[model samples]
Target chain A: MSQFLDFIPKIPVADSVEDAMDLLTDTFAGFFDVIKKSGKFSMEFVTDFLVMIPPVLFILIIAAIAFFATKRKFGLAIFSIVGLLFIYNQGLWEELMNTITLVLFSSVIAVIIGIPLGILMSKSKVAETIIQPLLDFMQTMPGFVYLIPAVAFFGIGVVPGVFASIIFALPPVVRFTNLGIRQVPKELVEAADSYGSTGWQKLYKVELPIARPTIMAGVNQTVLLSLSMVVIASMIGAPGLGRNVLSALQQAKVGNGFVAGISLVILAIIVDRLTQSFNKKRQ
Target chain B: MEKIKIENVSKIFGRHINQALKLVEQNKSKTEILKQTGATIGVYNANFTVNEGEIFVIMGLSGSGKSTLVRLLNRLIEPTSGNIYIDGENISKMNKKQLINVRREKMSMVFQNFGLFPHRTVLANTEFGLEIRGISKEERRLKAEKALNNAGLLPYKDQLPGQLSGGMQQRVGLARALANDPDILLMDEAFSALDPLIRKDMQDELLDLQQKVRKTIIFITHDLNEALRIGDRIALMKDGEIIQIGTGEEILTNPANDYVRTFLEDVDRSKVLTVENAMIRPISLNIDIDGPKVALQRMREEEVSVLLAVNKLREFKGYITADDALEASKKGENSVINYVRTDMPIVPPEMYIQDVLGIISDSKTPLAVVQEEKLVGVLIRGVVIEALSSSDENEGVTENVSIS
Candidate 1:
């Protein structure tokens, strides 16, 4: 194990840190340019189109979907309507969207990498042995500790913030994916074999499908972790409702701070409900 | 012809140097071998051949290498040293691609658990085998649908596996196997996971399917009764070695050792046996409704205590007795339970006289059904022993036979 540990990539400290931060801003600017100019990645355009519909109508549709999927119609309706009202009252609807976009982007990337790593770990004993300790460290390390190297490389703004969130949020996905795949019943594997499934076919058709519930659970945890990281990421110039809340608290503005906090809670609720609804549909 | 054969299979783990050192240092006895190297022989030089279309059973308790034997046939686990031939192909040396090809083309297995994918619809789970074989999606779907229909799960085709009952899940597993159209079926205690009634139904279903398909099968189970019911040839295993291999009748009559005998002891031989055991010539002209009367008179003339009855069509009715007939005649009553079916394997005429004595000792009227090929007759326990003992002309001989 010690022999294996020596092989991991070491973080370098140099002027390259400043260079990376500049590169992150440039890359983000290029992405925004592509979306704004070409209409290829315009989340703003998508949101504005959505916003054209009456807010009440959109909320009702979302609430109904949530209610059907969760079997909690009353709760979903109350949460959805109240949360929307709070976000508008706090004057943070746009900031809430920006924070949500960060969480969504980071979590999606985390899932893409983490799930495959998990599946690989479950399949190979060596992969499991290698990845498990790293995953453990990632899970246990302080949220503050995640920011240091993140800041060193990408430095101040949404890019480093996304990176830090990924560091914090990624472990649950990988851990649960591996756990889910590993815990798929041994009899199921044999059944797949008996069904004349090739190695790849069995993994896709039998193993992954059977492991869906647990993998979705991993996804749910990743989403929640990403949400938690948003407030922390706010300390480093990643603008969102978290920044307003922090500022209000510093200025001793109790009403403003409470409203900002309530808006954050609403954003969290919307994301949790939406992702959980998608998960329930799949199951 | 043999469809599957395993020869001199010895699966040993650990390096040779340790074994060599232990061989030199310790006494070369069984206990010493077990203690010295901590070497456990999972399958010790085991060998067997399964013929085409034969229902071959490996029956053993846990840790007896039965499951290991099935896995070895499919190369699920590599053997330490051996040769395995499937339809004369040397499977032990097949590479991964070749092995997968063999598994996909020639054989399929059923697990103790149904092993349906919870996330997939029954149709998709069934189609999984075809997907692995690289069949087109449309073709696989059609094939899977047909297989599901055959297994009586077509109605549940769109439902996830969790939506089905245990028995239905097992049917889906069966449909999945059938979808591949493999030549051989390997079942590793497939019915053991089901409720008793469901297990019996599944076993009957398997037998019915086997009748239609005639696929060579290797079934594993710990239950001797199930082994007798399903197996064309059974291999009773102990400690990773086969203790006996024979047909049900052969094993029942001539168990190879005490261990095999222990499994046979509680077996209801009457149920296990067929009409082959109880055929004998009738002794009278009264072959219809008065057959029981002739049987009773014959019992009296022979000085026998009991008589078996049969109807004119030669279907076995029950047994009757002269004492009961006389008592019935006086009382004017007719009851069928008084008669013992001649088709059943009662204690044989040639069995130990002690068993004959025991049978007679308990019943007010004891009957032994006499069989010769398919013909059925009746024999009384007392008359059989009286003949055997009187002909020997030695009273000591009877006691010696009983003691032995």
Candidate 2:
């Protein structure tokens, strides 16, 4: 039976993609180098600046901001304080800060790229039709598959880790922002149109405000997706709890992995809760 | 006199507009055009003039192209072919920037769903049109505040649309349109989504506002009663073409075809029709010259118990009853004024039949349909009965009106 099936073809799809990517990178080496330099500087500034701060002072600052945002609901501010203290007690403060920086920068960059793409998508059916399927593929593809392209494009480092996270996390914001604009009530759009609102005026005055809730939801989703890429990003030399978790797994240190993993969960909850609360407050 | 004139206007909602337009020009049926070119006819060769300061209503069932027609007037939905002239300028020929200018300065629309910005306060919503026109913040606020006050929504100026009731939100919509101070106000089923009671109030409010603003309004509605209640003239559409354009009374008295006749069948005539619709030519007895005996004879000949007495100038003096005239003749009074009773029931020709019901029921003598103190017509009990009965028999009346 094995001999009968021996003639089946095994296509080297991965090898072909790799070869094409290398040639593509070589052809655009100058562009890639510029990106590499920017990526390095940004990644270093964010992670180093965050890591240099004492964990207690950073945690207090966050708690105070949370206190102001959630003035009536002090429980949220208290929760942040307690959550950070727990992570700090576990002596993974630097790792926690590093992870926060990576997640924050990845989210910020994704939002910056995603919002314009979303607006573009909303403006043109051509853009929407082209980008939607690409977004679906980006969202559904395994996180591990993202690192290959990131590593090929930027090589291995925190920059590549950040790039992979951005690639993995971008789709929700784009899709959601497009959806948000599309979902604006036709009557409101008609009202705007009837008033002779110019394109930019219509977007800023009506479409953006109406689409705010949905866009915020998209941003929240992007943040969560970025967090989910943490451990996979660790494989590309992103320093954070993800790195500790990966090393813990390699060394079979289950207790160490649990502590690092819990800290990541803490950060994720903070972001998720803060954004959700902000959305509610806005409403 | 014409605020807006839609001439040979047509819209086909599909990509095959050129072919669809050719088919439209060929006068193909809407369904045939749709099948041939894959374009749904939004409006086809719609021709009508909305007079300045008149509430021109476009009424049809959903998908009857009423909404599409209003949208075309503002170029919100561009027509496939033909011209729309606003104040003698062809809007169809205008470029985008010119059209935008037209929208900004000449026209504003109120949507059915009260298109108030959810994130904006009522004041902000009102200021939207003014802001788009690049008005100063201070001026926009002043105008917005004035408009809001005019709409009777000043109390809710600070409230978000979500915080207000549907009626209040629609008032904000009205205020928004008003803030622009546009000469043309397009209301696309502005009150259709409202509750029955609220809809009535809004209709009345719009009427009141129209009297104040005197803006040329083109209103769209599916409700026949609403059209009849508010329209100075109404255009009834079917299959994207206006089949008839006439006054509400004209539409009812003389529908264009079976479609329009059927459309009017369910409308309550009491509210839609007026006393003039049911009034017959009144017998007038001259007050100065016609003798009491002559007045008595005229009443007997007309087989009516009373006759309206008027001066030589056709000014209504009063009415004289048969018994009063007979008494006057017995007393040898020469003029019918000797018997003319000044305290008889009189109704304006424009008074709704629903309103005349009480006067007719209360008075023994026929109610005189008076316009500016002149006896125009007389509404008898029999005429009221006949008018109402004929409204029930509406289905039989087709191609009845001689209106252009």
| Model 2 residue pairs with clashes | none
Model 2 regions more than 4 Å off? A1-12, B273-404
- Of candidate 2 chain B, the 10-residue stretch with the lowest lDDT total is B395-404
Per-residue lDDT of candidate 1, residues A1-283 (tens digit): 9879989877675558667767775768665444334331343444455556666776677678767777666787678877876676656776776676677777998999899999999989999999999988988888978787666555566666777888899998999999998888887787776555676777887788778878988998998898888878887766677778778878999988888887877777777777777777777
Clashes of 1: 10
TM-score of chain B of each: 0.66, 0.71
lDDT of 1 by residue, B265-382 (tens): 6654333332222223444322355644555567778775555555555544555556666675565544434444343345443343434445556655444344443224444444
What is the alpha-carbon lDDT of model 1 when measured against the actual structure? 0.72
Give the least accurate 10-residue stretch of model 1 chain A, judged by summed lDDT: A34-43
Instruction: Put down candidate 2 lDDT per residue, B319-339, tens digits, no spaces.
Output: 888889888899887876656
Best by DockQ: 2
In model 2, chain B matches the true chain B with a TM-score of 0.71
